[model samples]
Target: MNKQEYMNCAEEELLHTYNRFPVVLERGEGVYLYDTDGKKYLDFAAGIAVSAFGYGKKEYNDALKAQIDKVIHTSNLYYNTPVIEAAKKALAASGMDRIFFTNSGTEAIEGAMKAAKKYAYTRDGHAGHEIIAMNHAFHGRSLGALSITGTRHYQEPFEPLIPGVRFAEYNDLDSVKKQITEKTCAIFLETVQGEGGIYPAEKEFIEGIRKICDEHDILMVTDEIQCGMGRTGKMFAWQHYDVKPDIMTCAKAFGCGVPVGAFLMTEKAAEKSLVPGDHGTTYGGNPLVGAAVSTVFDLMEKENILEHVQEVAPYLEHALDALVEKYEFVSARRGLGLMQGLVLNVPVGKAAAKALEEGLIIITAGSDVLRFVPPLIIEKSHVDEMAEKLDKVFAQIEA
Candidate 1:
């Protein structure tokens, strides 16, 4: 079937959740994607920043294939070699003493919340602990994750969500402090807000949060689902600020392309929270995802993916800065490492659609920001190609 036929079939069968793009992507090669109609697109979205190693890396593929032959899964009741290795590597990467794997970022958040509440309960011998989350922050779509997500519209329809989640202003330390009470057990925020528009946490703001958590004995929970795993030129975005979170939720590029996520905590948080039977998942860290996770970390070290991101991010930033300077509609460029955004006066949705037509794939964050989260394997040439295509996109928008 052709592209439109496939799209129509999908719409007919699938539930209407996402307003998917017009193109039906067939496959990806490195930093580019091809549609069913054979049009090539320089991919800046990178499947929303999940394809860290880009498409079809031989080492990653080989690891998965080898694991497929060995074992795919064994229930959490049994121990598996791949999950053991994956856990050790993940703990080492995050500097966290304990880990709980989940199938997705949302599940990680749910686990983190439960752990935090359990910790507070263990300490005070009571429950009803509140969590302070930043306004405009986007955690996930699940009930527990969505409750703490500060956006109103997303929560209005799913009213009476897990209560006791208070909203605070992002980057405003004072606002965070005002929301804290003896009942406040945890504070959640994205290290670099992805869906809220690529806003990196300010040095003072994140550091201040650490200090507050330390003084109050509240767990600092950072959602690094989008900005972790070398997306920000560091293993985790919080590392850039030299501040450690008590509980860190990670997914996206954690397993590169596989479905896996984890909520990790320091030894201190581990000592008081979520003992056995508190949390369990049948397929969270099964052999299949474990192989993907372990291989992703192995390749990260073997290939020096972090250093490569550090090297190329500045060039992409420079190109984007030039666009901001050249275009009247482009107001600002903000973000860290490869996860960047351009704040525009024009409609971001229209601009993204135009870029797709020009054989480039870019996405939007918030309402006015054009998000750029290309694969970590992207090079200077890919950035150049993106800029050239975006220039045409901007020109068309102007016309």
Candidate 2:
């Protein structure tokens, strides 16, 4: 169907939750997407960092097809081969001892919050199990996740939210220290903030948090939903700081486009919190999604995706720096590895719309930042193409 047909069906049948772009993408190959009318677009957004291995990887496709022929899903009441295998791989890579899979990053955040609260209650009492989250941090949209999310605009309408949650300034060690109370259960943060504008946590700040958490016996929860799974040239973003979180949440590229997420805990928290009946999900960790997770991890290792990111990230960063140098409206660049954003003098939505019209698919974050989270498999040539297209978009903005 054409774009109009697709839009018509969506308008009639679907809830208008998102202000979606007009183009109807029909297919994707490598780093390019094609609309039904045969227009091509360089896909820098990568489905908001979901398609890490790019579109239609053969090994990934084969793994899913084989699993489909065998078994897609089985009740968690029974053991399944795919889940067991995937769990092992995930735990091994993440350095976490226990795992609970969920259907989305928001669900992972929910599970992590539950576990943290339960752990705190188990130790002290059920009286005051509060959480400390960073300001401008974007967790997820569920009530539990949304409560902890730092953006006030998103949370104002959903008030009287999960009580006892407080927000602290990102990368501010002193601010975090000031917010801590005896009631604090967990200190949640994104090692590299994503939707709040691609700000990577300062190493000293993370270290300070680790020290404080250790001192107070508070659980440290890091949300790697956007910056994990080799996006930052590391299996996990926390690895970059040389500090491990007591609990870690990951999704997005976890299944390389499949809707799967998980929260894993250290052995200590695993022993104390979320004992069986405390938390559960029906469709999480099923064989079908497990296959996707397992395949993504396997391909990342076999293809040396981390090394590739290490090599190409510098080039992408340099190109973005060049853009900053050339364009008056481009004020700053932030992020690490493939997850980067350009702070703009104009509204990010306007620049993004113009880029889309110029055959480039880009996205906005934090209202005034244009985020570039391309697939992990993107090469220098693709980066060049992106730069060229962005140049045109910038020129249009200047005019």
Candidate 3:
């Protein structure tokens, strides 16, 4: 069907959760997406950082096709070879001891929260067990993840969320220390805050968190859903700081477009929390999702994706810096590697909309930040194309 027809059908049937752009993407290749009307646009959003290998990579496609031919899924009750392989690779990649696969990032967050709380409950007897999250942090939309999310507007609508979740200022060790009580069970923060406008954690801040977690026995949970899997030129963003989280939640690019996510924990936390029947998922680590995940990791290794991201990321940051310099309304550029954001004095949603009209796809992180989370395979040429389109869009938008 045509773009208009697809959009009309979507409006008629689909839930209105997203204020979607007036475009229906039919297919994608490399860093470009084609609309149903055959219009081409550079995809800087990377399907919100899920399409890491970019759309239609031969290796990724082949792996999924091969797996589909063999078997799609079997219940988690029986062992799946692909599931074992995927879990091994994921554990190796993140340097975490144990993993529990889930269907999405929100599920990962929920699982992490449960694991942390359960561990605390084992010792603290379930009384006053609290979680401290950061101000401006965005974990997920589930009731558990939403409780720890710091934004009031998102939480205010769903009143009386899971209790004992408190917010602290991001990057401020003092604020975190102040929030800590004897009842505190875990401290969860994003290694790089994505939806809160691409803020990378300071080295001192992460290190301090590690120290506090050590001293107080609080689980340090880092949500790496948006910034992990070589998006930040490393296997995980926490590696950049040289401080490890006791538990980490990863997704988005984890399955390379397949629906998969996981919560990984250190051996200590793993042994202490979530005994066999505490939590489970039917499709979490089934053969289908497992194949997609293992293929992503295999391709990352075979293609040297981490090195490519490291090499090309500077070009992206340089181009974004140029925009910050040229546009008076553009205030700053911040982020690690390809997961960058251009802070705007104007509304970010307006700027992104304009870029979409000019054959470019960008997204908003917070209220006034344009997020640039392109595919890891994008080269200097694609960066130039994105910057050029963004420049035109910036010129059209008022401060």
User: Candidate 3: minimum summed lDDT over ten consecutive residues — where?
Assistant: 121-130
- Over 1-399, each residue of candidate 3 has an lDDT whose tens digit, in order, gives 777888999999999899999998889998899988889999999999999988989988988889999998888789999989999999999889999999999999999999999999887777569999999999999888889899998899898899998889999999999999999999999999999989999999999999999999999999999999999999999999888899999999999888899999999999889998999998898888999999999999999999999999999999999999998899999999999998898888888889999999999998989999999999999999989999888888853
Model 3 spans > 4 angstroms off: none
Tens digit per residue, CA lDDT, model 1, 159-224: 889989999999999999999999999999999999998999999999999999999999999999
- Tens digits of lDDT, candidate 2, 211-260: 99999998999999999999999999999989999999999999988889
* RMSD in Å for all candidates: 0.7, 0.8, 1.1
Cα error of candidate 1 at position 324, Å: 0.4
Q: Considering every candidate listed, which one attains the maximal lDDT?
A: 1
Clashes per candidate (backbone, < 3 Å): 0, 0, 0
Off by over 4 Å in 2: none
Better of 1 and 3 by lDDT: 1
Candidate 3 RMSD to the real structure: 1.1
Show the lowest summed lDDT stretch of 10 residues, model 1: 25-34
**Which one wins by TM-score: 2 or 3?**
2
Q: How many backbone clashes can be found in candidate 1? A: 0
Better of 1 and 2 by lDDT: 1
Higher-ranked by TM-score: 1 or 3:
1
